[model samples]
Target: MPYIASFDIGTTNAKGVLVTHEAKSILEKSVPITTIQTEHTAEQNPDQWLDAVLKITKEWLSVGIRAKDIAAITFSGQMQDCIPVTAEGEPVRPAILYSDARAGKQAERIKDELGTALIREKTGNHMDGTLTFPKIIWLQEQEPVTYEQTASFLISAKDYVIGKLTGRLVTDPTSAATTGVMNLEKRTWQTDWLERYGIAADKMPEICPADEVVGQVTEQAAKKTGFAPGTPVLCGIGDAGAATIGAGVSQQGEMYAYIGTTGWIAIPTKEVTYAGEGVFHLTHPEPGMHIAIAPLMNAGNAYKWAMSVFGTNTKMSDKFAFQEMEEQMQASDRRTSNLLFLPYLNGERCPVQNPDATACFIGIKATTKREEMCIAVLEGVAMGMKQVMELISDASDYKRITLIGGGSKSKVWNQIIADMLGLEVLVPEESQYLPSMGAAALGFINLGWDSDYQAFSQRLTAAQTFERYIPDPAMSEHYEHKYRRYIKLYPALEPLFETSLDSE
Candidate 1:
């Protein structure tokens, strides 16, 4: 049986999986990639990603996985990263992460020049500092010497790996769409827009379809990764697009929610559907499909914050922290509570595009208890997701939702989402590997082992059982009322957030 190697280069870690032609996992490995985060900056060395991949491949080869057995390799990575590299594919500096907000001034300049309406029409996304163009502009203004030396600006994390492997600077349409420089309708780089922003055309990578064979493993890469020389490498997609296909969301009106450190609600559409401002529109990994995305900057990380504040003094282990918190949440009243939380710990994306937004606890009083606050955090994130669902529903009707990612492991959170959205939520078995599996599916297609992704996905997910969560009628109604209040808190607190003396 031929094997395909899939890689998912995430914000915090890089995961590798070997899958059979039939899409069964044979072996999996992951290694941490260090992220250098500061108050207004988040960066990671692109070299760290290559190191992690090398480590994973070395371990797999040591365990008797022959290089020749692998048919093709594909990647899925964190989207919207700014990695500037030399002509020889060496990073000039640390990669600016998607969460980095140091390019706010540059983003404002772009908005002033191009206007948000034109940007939305051209790119299908709003102007934000987290995007690729603004980050590149920041490099030009703030670090001119380095920017001048930079030969290419890669967008997605996997693109960096692709550069190192094939010595070709290229990106997939799904990843390029997030760069704020791609013409969404044409699925190509917007060279005119880049020039207007003072970005050279040569600085951008060539765009390719996610399933196309962009290059092959070079002799150096083959030696380093234990792969056969000239093994085909497909132009893979961003993690969100991969996860969408991986979660079996191939049809129109099908939706999925991914809650990692950040969270997003994505739905496949036959045409471009803009869900107002702050929502993202990107090309799906599958040709001719579009994904309407609403992303929240904080989701699983909010739960981490709660655990740090409330679970630190307890004797519970990290693994059981969420379980204990779930028990606490279950003990609380199901109807409603006075406390509400704004999950803007890392600012926010979608709905509200403010980088100055801060996390806060509202409706706190002498009667507020610790458990109520904990449950409030869960509800707050759920309410945030509800806002995204509403935006998506505005564009298209999606009744069933598939939930995937690290946050899908929590039944309590899943229930809260189901109740908040008043929709059926299905959590797939082995949800964490969905992105990798999606990448593997792309590899299979490129190698002619599969005719289409939809059929491959259906077959792969057919045997997988999902835990279903239905909305409680009473709780759904209660959350509907609370959601009204939750939406109001952000606008009411906006003035204060701008005037506050807090400095990043």
Candidate 2:
């Protein structure tokens, strides 16, 4: 049986999955990619991403999977990473990650010069430090020597790996859209904006359709990784887009919620729909489709923080931490809790685009227990997701939402999201592999294993096994009241956060 290899180059790890032509994932592997972080910066070496790919491929090959059996390779990855490479595809330095805030001043300058209306119309996104343009400007101002030596700027984690394998520097529309450089309607680079911002046009990589075959694995890449020479490589989509496809959200108005380290509520749209500022409109992997996304900086990480604080006992094993937390959350009343949490632990992106926003647990009294705090964290994230859901609904109506990513594993959290959104939520089996499956689906279409994306998506959707959650009317009413209070927390705390940042 022919197989396709799909790679998901994520923030914490690079995951590889081998899927049969029938869409069954036969084997999967992963390797950690370190994020070098400081106060306002986060980065990773591009070479490390390649290394993880090589490591996973070697492991798969050793297990007796022939290189020839793999028909094509495709990718889905973390977006908004800025990797400056030489003409020969050598990294000038470590990549600037999407979470890096070192380009805050540059981003502000770009916003001031370009104006919000023009940027929103051109790029389909707001000006933010977590974009490639600002990071490039940061390099030009802060490290002129490095900037001068740079040949091209690559966006997304998988773009760097694609360059290394095929010796071609290219980006897909979905990934390029995040750079704040691509014209959303045209699906190409905005040369006028580049010139206005004083950014060189040559630094931008060529944009390609997500499933187009851009190049093949060169001899060098074939030797380093265990792939056969001349294996077809498709220009892949961004992780969010891939996850949308994998979750069976291909038609207009179909929606999905992704909860990884970060989270977002994404809905597929046929036309360019703009939700005011702080919401993102990005290209979909499928041709002529767009995805409106409202991203959150904190989701699973907030849960992780709670775990670290409450699950540090010597007897507490990592395996049991989730179960214990779930039990704690279920111990509390489902309808009411006096405590409220603002899940801006690492700042926020969607709904409120504040970088200095800090997390707070309001209504904390002497009688509050640690268990209530944990429950509050879950509820806080649910409320934040509901905020994004409302923003998407402002543009279009979506009743059913498919949940994917690490956070989907928690039934307690899933139920909370359903209750908060007052909508039906569906969790697919093997939800974490959604992104990889999406990439594999693209690969299959590019290789002619499938006729078209819509047909492929339908088959995959029909095959998917799901668990559905229905919202309780009483619980939904309770959350509606709490959500009103949650929206007030950020405005009330904005002045305090601003003062702290200014003092620092």
Provide the overall lDDT of each model, using Cα atoms, as 2-decimal numbers. Answer: 0.86, 0.87
Task: Tell me each candidate's RMSD, in Å, in order.
Answer: 2.0, 1.7
- The lDDT leader among the candidates is 2
Candidate 2 residue spans exceeding 4 A from truth? 312-317, 394-396, 501-504
TM-score of 2: 0.96
- Tens digits of lDDT, candidate 1, 404-497: 9888988888898898888899999878888888888888777787788788878788857889999899988889888889999998999988
Per-prediction TM-score: 0.96, 0.96
On residues 1-504, what C-alpha lDDT tens digit does candidate 2 reach at each position? 688899999998898999887788867887988999886788999999899999999999999999999889999999999999999999999999998878888989988988988888888888888899889989998999889889999998999999999999999998898998789989989998778767789889999888988899999999889799999998998998889889888887677899998889888887665665778888987677888888989998899889888764636775688788888777778665768999998888888888778899999888888888888898999999988778777522656789999889989899988888888999998888889999888887887888877777787777789999998999989898998999999988888888864576
Off by over 4 Å in 1: 312-317, 394-396, 502-504
Which 10 residues in a row give candidate 2 its minimum summed lDDT? 391-400
- Predicted structure 2: lDDT: 0.87
List the lowest-lDDT window of 10 residues for candidate 1: 391-400
- What's the true lDDT of residue 439 in model 2? 88
